[model samples]
Target: MAVSQHASVRKTVKEDLGAIVEMIQELADFEGMSDGPKLTIQDLLRDGGFDDGVLSNSVPLFHSFVLELTEQIRTGNKGKITSCSSNDEPLTRTTIIGYAICFYSYSTWQGKSFFLEDIYIKPNYRKRGYGELLFKTVAQHALENGCKRLDFHVLAWNPAKYFYNRMGAENLTESEQWEFTVCQGKKWMHLPKTIPSGSKPLKS
Candidate 1:
């Protein structure tokens, strides 16, 4: 099926956290990691600058974008359309179908870069160009913010890698042997003391 012409992408607001987290779980389930997602709506609110406690002028730790389509496009989809207007004049209800999460990072060799933590479209919504629309939207956001590079990781077996390749993304793991690593929980907490005391700082 073709993507709805009324589909649109925009920066996420505080209200979008619930839908975003739900889709995050859906993506995890699709990847065969149903228990992988550990984020909560409170976390998104704080990290995305939607929490009132967060300083208004401070840059958020992350940014998100969501893709929405009007109710007319989701007519027969069970449990997809949540609310509708009382009037009969073409229900203007919208539903969040996809989302992208991103954060900025610095590269000593390349300056500013943007990292796409996740991007996902509903299973029923895939193959209709919505994923590409969301991906391009994130890329444009990166460019507008002066990012020189956009980076993300895809599982070696994921078919989405082909889509990314078509969009001109490079596989650094294959081309440059760049491996992704992570440290969390106790390991991350102890990382500060792991450095040798006598280690000398390298000159910049």
Candidate 2:
């Protein structure tokens, strides 16, 4: 069956963390990087605006949206879209099938930009336009937030690259003189000596 036309995308609730984490693990496994999903519910709770102590007046460090079907769209139940609240009570979204996670970043050349960390739809939910829906939602969010551009990385051999290109994604590394660098594992764990308390750098 195709995705229902009434699928709804909504901001994630605090209680959605468990389901989100499960989907994250599924995505990691799909990408053959099982180690990538190190996030925990507590991490989401602490860093995802659920804890008021960490809320920033500036833009949130990240945001997520979940795709779920309204009861009217489902086969039998006639449930309406329920608004998610900050309370610990879980959302009634048994129809949830996909999610998009995004963050904002600053580019010296272009000011603010949107970074899509991950977007995934369950295999059974693929080819129903849900992924595209999530993508367009993210693009709209970027424009609404005054972002100069939206960016994300794709696996070189993944067929999704063609889909992204069809969506007008630019190959920054090939067309622009941009280089991507990453530091992880031991390299990420090790720290260089701290700078002297009051040392000034010599002019080059």
Kindly provide the TM-score of model 2 when superposed on the true structure, using C-alpha atoms: 0.78
| Residue pairs of candidate 2 with colliding backbone atoms | none
Tens-place lDDT per residue, model 2, 1-204, is: 112346778888887878899999999999999998888887776777766656533445689999886542232233343443334232433578899899989889999999999988888988888888888898998999899999899887877888788788998888986887898877676544354656746659
Query: What is the C-alpha local distance difference test score of each model?
Result: 0.85, 0.78
Tens digit of per-residue lDDT, candidate 1, span 44-99? 88778898865443778998999998755333443344453333223355889999
Clashing pairs in 1: none
lDDT of 1 at 45: 82
Off by over 4 Å in 2: 1-5, 54-59, 71-94, 194-204
For all predictions, the C-alpha RMSD in Å is: 5.3, 7.1
Report the number of backbone clashes for model 1: 0
